[model samples]
Target chain A: MLVQFYNVSKVYPKGKALDDISLKIDRGEFVFLMGPSGAGKSTIIKMMFREEEPTRGQIFIAERSLVRMKRSDVPRVRRGMGIVFQDFKLLERKTVYENVAFAMEVVSAPHREIKARVPEVLRMVGLEDKENSFPGELSGGEQQRVGIARALANQPLLLIADEPTGNLDIDTSLEILDLLIDINRKGTTIIMATHDRELVKAARKRVILLDKGKVAADYAPGEYLVC
Target chain B: MLKNIWYFCREAVKSMARNHLLSLATISTVAICILILGMAVLATLNASHLITRLESDLEIMSYLDKDLTADQASEVKQALEAIPGVESVRFVSREEALQYLQDSFGEDRYNLEETMGKNPLPDGYEIKALDPHQVPVIAQQVEQVAGIERVNYGKEMVNNLFLATKWVRVLSMAFIVLLSLGAIFLIATTIRLAIFSRRKEIYLMKLIGSTDWFVRWPFFIEGILLGTAGSLIAILLLAVGYETLIGSIQSVPFVPVLSNRALLIEVYAGLVMVGALLGVLGTYISLNRFLDV
Candidate 1:
């Protein structure tokens, strides 16, 4: 298992956000956290990245216990995973090439490695031709591709994307899904949280449905749609 | 680390340029604060210097017995010099004392000599203490010496000067400390506003696995740059104003102001260091709120 949650719970001032949730994701699996708003899908994703600590219970990512991890060690763990956002957060002033290279720069990668890898990652996202274009000039789909490319620059073991296609049209959403599926095929575990029921059904991946901060269903590929 | 610093500097410059108006405001505020602080420091320095000059000039005048022989008077001088706190003792003969009075009379010296047929001035030994605070004690010791008639050292005036300067030093020190705190708070608030403007950028940096330090380095550099620039302006202004004031007062007598080039350089260096320190502190306080993620 690449990720494990042992009876984890998260409590806020108002109420419990995640109540005694437990699940496991193996390496190279494409898992969809399908739920409506306030389903704790985002909360679980946040815990996996150590953005929020579990109020109770333990979480282990890559066999390292996140509950016991030091605050200073968060960056090192985060570098091992990529994160994509719905709004496609990219520095508007930077070109497509610089945007992707920023991830490596933040880690202080060697100049030679940054020079060689940035173009490679941009090409992987099929944005090699738009390497010099600014985010403001790019279309919405192209911008998200840049976001994915930047995330992949570190060559993470897992990719956690929250609502990656929440703002896209149906056709563009499917295009992004195909790209995600292609990346997963190349041996990267992906856990995406989204409310787009049709998109999840189309991906044909393992689905973990959450409702009211608890796991509602755990179904294998092609099985979730049947239920 | 060197590479990271370089990147941080570049980003800091970029951010500064992006918010040129805000940057200018912060720099000017720093400059004004430092300028006021520098003036206060210079004032206190000058006040203390003047007091020290006056204290050094303070001396006890020990009158010799009118009938004492030259040998006995010389013995009193030797005894005064032997005192632990005595720097030196100069024996002034009655003739020299009379001549000093004559010189003071200027054109009327002949009239003063004609009015008093014989020189009745008593000879005195001028005693200078090593420490100004020991002047009274040294005067008392001088009076106890044989052949010494009386000792006078302007006791009340010296005590008043010391008391006044003590208050001046205390008040200035308190003022400087309060001003420093005010400056730090101002810089912190300004930097906080600047950081607040780019909160989204900081959030994204945190999301992308940048360490808190990594995200903070740029803002730190920006703050330091602002502080340095502000202090430089203040130093420039202070140097010019001080130099001009010194020029205007050059012909004036008895007013001791700081004019040592080395000392002025040291003060400027101190201001720069203080400015940079404030910058770092302000950046740290401002960045603390945003880096929790």
Candidate 2:
């Protein structure tokens, strides 16, 4: 197991966001967190990366307890995984090449390695030709590809995408899903949160359905469609 | 590490150019504050220098009894020199004293010499003390010496001058400290504004696992650049103004101003160092809030 959540719960002043939620994910597995808005899907994804802490439970990523980790160690943990956002957070002024290279630069990668890896990752995302284009000049799908390239720059072992296709159209969304599936086949664990049932059905992967801050069902491929 | 620093510097310069108006405002504020501070320091330095010159010029004049012979006068000079605080003593004979008076009379010297036929001036010793503050005590000791009839050193005037110079030093020090605080505050606000404009980028950087120092380096470099630039401008202005003032006052008598090139260079160097320090302090203050991620 790569991630394990034991009886995790979160409480806000309004009410509980996650109640007694326990789940596990294995290495190289592609899991879908299916839930409607306000169903605590984002909260679970946040907890995996240690962005949000559970009110009462233990969270282990690769056997290290996130709840007991030091503040200084948070960045080291985050570097082991990549996060994709809904809006495609790319610096508008930077070219596609620079946007991706900035990630490695921040981690103090060697100059030669950065020069070699940036174009390779951009090419992996099929954006090698758009390297010189700024975000403002690219379409929404191209920008999202840039975001993915930047996330993959560090070659993390796991990728947590929260509504990564929420802003894209149906065709573009499918193309992104295909790209993610290709990445997952290359042995990176993937957890994507979304409310689109059609997208989940298309992936035909393991699905964990959440409702009212609790787990409603956990189904394997084809089992969710049958039910 | 060198590459990272180079990247940080490039980012800093780019951000500064992007926010040129705010950067200009911050630089001007720093320049004005430092200019006033430099002026206050120069005033204090020059005032103290003048006071020192005046004190060094002070001498105790002790009159000898008219009945003392030349041999006895030389003995009195030796006695004054033996005093603990006395640096040196010079004997003024009656003839030299008369000659001094004649020179003071200038064109009327003949009339003064003919009006007083006999040489009635008394012999005296001019006494210099090692420490100006000890002049009063030395004068008292000299008055007690035998054959010394009286001593005069303008005690009240010296005391008043010392008091005035003390106030000048204290006030200027206070002014410089307050101005430094103001400069730091301004730089802090400027850096805070810069941080605000790039807050989203900072958030993304943190989310991507950038270390706190990585996120902080660009802003730190920006603050340092702002501070160094402001101080350099102020120093240039100050140097030009001081040279002009010195030129205008060269012919003025009894005013001891600072004109040494090496000392001015030292003061300028000190100002630049202080400006850079203020920049670092301001950056630290502003960046503390955003680095928690």
Candidate 3:
């Protein structure tokens, strides 16, 4: 298994966001987490990214204790995984090419490596023709494609998408889901959190249902249902 | 590190140029302050040189009575030499004194023989002091000597010159202090204004996981460039100003000796350091408040 959550519970001052949650997904597994509002779906992905930590117990990605890692080491943990957010988080002023190239630059990858790798990533996202375009000039779907290109630029072993299609229509949403599936087929482990039951049923992938924090059901090739 | 500094400088220069009014204000403030300080330094140097020159040149003149017997005149000369601060006392014989007057006035056509019914001059001791300020005290003591008719120590003129020198020092020091403060404040505010304007970029850089050094380099480099360029300008102006205005004084030798060339360079060097330091310090201060937020 590449991830393990050992009796982990995350509580905010307001209330418990995650209550004694425990689950493990192995390497190269494509899993979907389906949950209702305030069910800790975002919290789970945040914990996995080391953006937030559980209140008790422990969590590990690649068998490294993310709960115990120093704040400065968060980048190193992130270096191993690619994450996509709902908002795209793209630098609006920068060109599409520079936006994708930024991730490699942060890791101190040599100039030639960035130059060679950026175009390849842009090509994979099918935005090769729009590499010179800015994010403001692109549609939501196209901007999300740039975000995916940025996330996957460093070839992270794991790709986590948090509500990736939360802001898109049914047609555009499925297009994004297909891109995530395509990225998974290329050998990257994928963990996606979403509330789109119709899409989950259509995709037929492994699904974990969270009801009020704990995992209510874990099913292989399952539908997105809490019960 | 070199590459980072170069990149940092390039961005800083570009931004400063884009914000032309701000760069001009910073440079102007630095120049005005430095110009004032440069003038103060030059004036102070001149006044000090003059005081020392006057101190070395002052002498005690002990005039003898024209009716003094030969022995009485000799006694006065010997007594004047014994006074403290008297380095040497030369006896000016009546005939020698008369001949000196003729030589000095010959060109002026002043007939000394017609001015006096007789050779009305008398022998006296022209006494030199180690310092001019001591001339008055020595003159007072010389007044008590027998056979000495009067003393011509030029006390009144010397006292007025000393007072003028003191006033110059007081005024210049005040000017330099005021100007330095003006420069510090100007540079600090210039940097603050610049940093305040681009605070959005800084916030984004921080959230993007850029380290403190990565964020600080641009502001640090901007300060240095402003200081260097402004000071360099001041130095060039000072160099030209000195050559045009002060060069004549140097050749005249009668003008108090001042190290014009050196002070001009010091003004530039001082401004450069001061300007840069103020820029960096001001940026650091502003960043502390802004970054912590």
Better candidate by DockQ, 2 or 3: 2
Give one digit per residue, the lDDT tens place, for model 3 in A1-227: 88899999999999999999999999989999998988989999988876688899899889899887775666667778877878888876679998888766555556788899999999998999998999999999999999889889888888888888888889999998899889889899999999998889878899989999999989887444333
Model 1, span A1-227: residue lDDT tens: 99999999999999999999999999999999988899998899999888899999999989899997888998888989999999998988889999888888988888789999999988888889998999999888899999999889999999999999988998999899999999999999999999998888898999999999999999999887876
Better candidate by lDDT, 2 or 3: 2
Give model 3's DockQ, 2 decimals: 0.10
As for lDDT, the candidate ahead, 1 or 3, is 1
| Positional deviation of residue B2's Cα in model 3 after best superposition, in angstroms | 6.3
How good is the docking of model 3, by CAPRI class? incorrect
Model 2 chain A worst lDDT run, 10 consecutive residues? A218-227
Tell me each candidate's RMSD, in Å, in order.
Answer: 2.0, 3.4, 7.7
What DockQ does predicted model 2 obtain? 0.60
For model 3, the superposed segments whose C-alpha errors exceed 4 Å read A1-26, A30-75, A81-83, A160-163, A191-227, B1-211, B230-259, B285-293
Top TM-score: which candidate number?
A: 1
State the C-alpha lDDT per candidate. Answer: 0.91, 0.88, 0.79
Error of 2 at B179 (Å): 0.9
Residue B289 lDDT, candidate 3, scale 0-100 = 54
Q: Rate residue A77 of model 2 by lDDT.
A: 83
**Candidate 1 per-residue lDDT over residues B1-293, each given as its tens digit:** 88888899999999999989989988998999999999999998998888889889999988989999878877877888888999988888888988888888786637665788888889899888899999988888888999999888998998998899899899999999999999998999999999998887788778778899899999989999999999999999999999999999977987777898999899999999899888888889889999988
